[model samples]
Target: MRPVVFPHWFHRIRFRCKVCHAELGFKMRAGANQIKMTDIIDGRFCGACHDGETAWSVENCDLCHSGKAGLPPGIFGGHETLGPGRW
Candidate 1:
């Protein structure tokens, strides 16, 4: 199964940064949070809103987990670094 390709830019257009970063308590740093399907199913993280009402339900596997397979993990489309100026 392909990993979920989280359309950050797409979500950014609909909601503000605080929606996920602040209110949801998501870390600003990429790959900072170790997300799990169980947590989301329990109404945490993405589940906070994606419970079929605010957003799509997690049952829709293909919806989110659509990333290409065999890709190196750790924030796709961006460079994985230690921190500011640590790259």
Candidate 2:
């Protein structure tokens, strides 16, 4: 299956770490969550906010899943880094 690109900047801009990690209960480490389409569809994991009404819907797969492993350097798209930038 394709991997999900968790947009840290996007999330952090609108929410706090505790919102997803504590209130929504997302795992900190990668590969820790047994994420499945069904789980997301059932309002679990990413589905908590991506339920269309809350945030974007999960069916809009292309927004998150690029199907490509880590993007190459120089492709940062105006950002200084892959995530946190120059901080």
Candidate 3:
């Protein structure tokens, strides 16, 4: 399966950081939470807003899973970086 290319900038424009970090329990950093499909299906994590009411449902796999195969899973298309030679 392709890694989900999460558009953090998109969400940041619509919601505050606390909305997901404090309220929904997502960590400030990527890969900090061990997200599972079962948890989302059970209405946890992304499912909280993506239940087809607040946002699109998980049934749309292409929306999120748009990253190329072999790419690391995490937030994408942002300016946040660890500087040159960090990786």
Instruction: Look at candidate 2 and tell me the lDDT of residue 80.
Output: 37
Give the per-residue Cα lDDT of candidate 3 at 58: 85
Question: Given candidate 2, what's the lDDT at residue 50?
Answer: 88
lDDT for model 1 comes to: 0.75
Top candidate on TM-score is 3
Q: Candidate 2's residue-wise lDDT over 1-87, tens digit each?
A: 345666666676677668977987777654466677898899987888889998889778877775476642111132234455544
Using Cα atoms with residue i matched to residue i, what is each candidate's TM-score against the true structure? 0.77, 0.69, 0.84
Better of 2 and 3 by lDDT: 3
Q: Which tens-of-lDDT digit does each residue in 10-44 have in candidate 3?
A: 88768887988999889877778888878788888
Cα lDDT listed for each candidate: 0.75, 0.66, 0.80
Ranking by lDDT: 3, 1, 2
Q: Every model's Cα RMSD, please? A: 5.2, 5.2, 4.7
Q: What pairs collide in candidate 2? A: none
Q: Give the winner by lDDT.
A: 3
* Collision count for each candidate, in order: 3, 0, 0
